[model samples]
Target: ADSLSCVRILRKMRERVSESISKMKADMSRAEEQARREYERERRHEYDSAAYLISMNKQSAEKSKAALPHLLTMSDHLGVDLLHLSGSALSTVFDMKEMSSLKS
Candidate 1:
């Protein structure tokens, strides 16, 4: 009878150990899932930010290009021919001043 009780105790201990192991495994799986979800959310946010930046850069490039014709017209009105001033120091000076003023 004592041997039987010992056997039963051993079995109960094994059962408890098994239950603890299973609980630990479940906890680990839940932690992994949460980590995966958080990583995915961060990746999506980074992708969205990158896409927005790309779109903004494209828009800015288009705007800059579009303004070129107006700049050329203004230079013509000022009697400054780019072709004639292609290698002139005065032309470079004027161009720099114009660009600085435009930024301001």
Candidate 2:
């Protein structure tokens, strides 16, 4: 009867050990899943930030493109005005030289 009790005790110990191992495996699986979720969240945040920056850059480029024709038109007008002013100044100088020659 004592040997039979010892066998039963051994079987109960084995069962407890098996239960502990299963519980540990479940805990490890939960931890791994939590870690994977956190990693995916971080990656999603990074992707969103990058996408926003790209969108802003695209808008800035389009604004610059839109301004180019107006800037070119203003530049052309300034060039024509400068040439007209230069011609007027040259004509005044020539008239002054002619008057001085006639007085002499």
Candidate 3:
């Protein structure tokens, strides 16, 4: 896909992840324990699947550039302490997008 398409996909994924995390954390009146458990389970599932994808021997600074922040945020929701992966690559992808926009 083109850079613009990549950016759009990234934005959509970010919005979905943010919305899911927000809903999982909203309102904890009485069912606090239950909600916490559910959120934990969701996090584990998301993280596990992502880990599997990353392990497919295809992830790299270039190949997975657009996914760095999305993975970071998702891992954050999963409470997984992590450093920014492929950070420079992600920035390069965004920078390329900016340059492309200028030419468009």
Candidate 4:
């Protein structure tokens, strides 16, 4: 009877241990999946930000293209030398040909 009781106790312990291991494995898998999802979310955000900047850059280039002729005319009428403008200000103007090359 004593040995039978010991055997039953051992079986119950084994069952509990198996359950605990399974629970641990499940928890680890969930943690890994969460980490993977977070990484994907971060990458998606980076791509979205890059796309937004590219769209803004294209819009700015178009506006510059449309305004260039009028701006040059005004500068000439006002006797303003564009070449004497600050380098930083000049850098904001994108030539259409230069912009095309940058896309590739």
Candidate 5:
């Protein structure tokens, strides 16, 4: 990884102990910043991905909530089959604990 590479480079610079020690120190600073930026970028990306999935799950739950009444009305017309179908649909939808977990 870039971090390990940075460490190796710093070790080499230290062992050499040439006139460019000052320049190597500056290089190390830059390497540290690069590693920090890379870490932040990866973290931000993961956060965004998780947030997007949570938003989608919440959207699906909202859709299911909205459809429940309509499903009930249709079930009244379709009888047992629709009743079972709606039950299965309800089970697939996220419950309160699931929603809370997604938020966290």
Candidate 6:
């Protein structure tokens, strides 16, 4: 009878150990799942941020390209015309002085 009781006690102890092992495995799996989810979230955020920066750079490049022709036209019209006008004005002033000296 005593031996039978010992056998029953050992079986109970094994059953408790099995339950503890299952519980530990369940906890480890849950921790792994949580970690995976966190990593995915971080990766997704990085991808979104990189995509936004690339899109913004593309838009800025397009804006710069669109302004190229107008910038060139304006520089040609304003800058060249102003230089020409200044030269002509100086010539006219010098010619007037020469005419005055000849008259006097």
lDDT of each: 0.43, 0.40, 0.41, 0.44, 0.42, 0.40
Residue 31's lDDT within candidate 3 is 35
Q: Write the per-residue lDDT of candidate 3 for residues 1-104, one digit (tens) a residue.
A: 69889788666644656654343233211133444455465566466765444433222222233333444576676554324334454334333221121100
Give the winner by TM-score: 5
Which is the better candidate, 4 or 6, if ranked by lDDT?
A: 4
On TM-score, the stronger of 2 and 3 is 2
Q: Write the per-residue lDDT of candidate 4 for residues 5-101, one digit (tens) a residue.
A: 8667645543444443344335434544554565565566466766555555554444344434434454464455544444344333321222222
Which sections of candidate 3 miss by over 4 Å? 19-84, 89-104
Sort every candidate by lDDT, greatest first: 4, 1, 5, 3, 6, 2
- Give me the runs in candidate 6 sitting further than 4 Å from their true place: 1-47, 80-104
Deviation of model 4 at 77, angstroms: 0.7
TM-scores for the candidates: 0.32, 0.31, 0.25, 0.34, 0.35, 0.32
TM-score of 3: 0.25
Model 1: lDDT of residue 93:
31
Best-matching candidate per lDDT: 4
User: If ranked by TM-score, best first, what sequence of candidates would result?
Assistant: 5, 4, 1, 6, 2, 3
Distance from true position, residue 37, model 3, in Å?
34
lDDT of candidate 5 at residue 37, scale 0 to 100: 60
The segments of candidate 4 whose C-alpha lies over 4 angstroms from its true place after superposition are 1-47, 83-104
Q: Which runs in model 5 stand beyond 4 Å of their true positions?
A: 1-47, 86-104
